[model samples]
Target: MAKTNYQELVFDITRLIPPGRVCSYGAIADYLALGSARMVGWALRNSFIHDGIPAHRVVNSKGELSGRAHFNPPSLMQQLLEAEGVKVENDRVVNFKEVFWHPEELGW
Candidate 1:
């Protein structure tokens, strides 16, 4: 598959994360098993053109919105996550383990 297709694969899976939930780039990468977590972040960073991605739902392994800078105004990432009832304090999701959703273990 081409690079774009790979990105689409990443997006396709990202779209599946239910509301009030979050997933790490590493989990998505592990589930897809085609790219690394950094690649997932890269794909999401360039995903601005697409709608419904909920890119905000993706964060670093430590539950930090490391990709926040890619969002317009940057704070938008944390805002979106807050809107979903996923609390983010200090740019890190609060109680990350509970809110975390693993695509692999979830049968994605």
Candidate 2:
């Protein structure tokens, strides 16, 4: 896929993440057959400005808000997640497995 297309795919998948649920960068990368979690992070870093893409819903595999630094306020990502009822403590989701949304399970 073209670079722009790949980025778009990342954003699209991110948007599908339900409120209060999170998906890992590796999951999104694997869903698109990209084989690189960093690619998903790169796309999110560049496309986060797009209004429809809920970039905050994407987290690191360990359920940590590793991408928090990329947000404008940095803490915005945690705030957003908390607003949706996803508890975050010490920069990590409190009940990660309970709230994790897997792309493969969605059959997308």
Candidate 3:
């Protein structure tokens, strides 16, 4: 079988995330056996154009704004996430436990 690139892996993980829920960089990286959480972030950063990565739906382990700077208009990510019914406060998700979407949790 052929190997999948980082961006494609990132997109696959992103697509798995359902609406109204979110995953973290660490979770996706750990699930894919990637190098590190930062590598996930880098994948998302560049996924903007090439892949329609739902980058906005990814947060930090504690549901923090880890990939904020990668958004097109700076705050667009937060706005998009908020529009999805995810509460945002101080650039972080208000209730992480409620919105956290880990692959194992969903049997994915």
Best by lDDT: 2
Write the candidate numbers in order of decreasing lDDT. Answer: 2, 1, 3
Evaluate residue 62 in candidate 2 and report its C-alpha lDDT on the 0 to 100 scale: 98
The lowest-lDDT stretch of 10 consecutive residues in candidate 3 is 1-10
Model 2: CA > 4 A from native = 1-4
TM-score for each model: 0.92, 0.92, 0.90
lDDT of 2 by residue, 46-98 (tens): 87667888889999999999999999899999999999999999999999999
RMSD (Cα, Å) for all candidates, in order, is 2.2, 2.1, 1.8
lDDT of 1 by residue, 2-89 (tens): 4458889899889989899999999999888887999999988878999889889999999999998998899999999898899889
TM-score of 3: 0.90
Candidate 3 residue runs with Cα over 4 Å from true position: 1-3, 106-108
Error of 2 at 39 (Å): 0.6
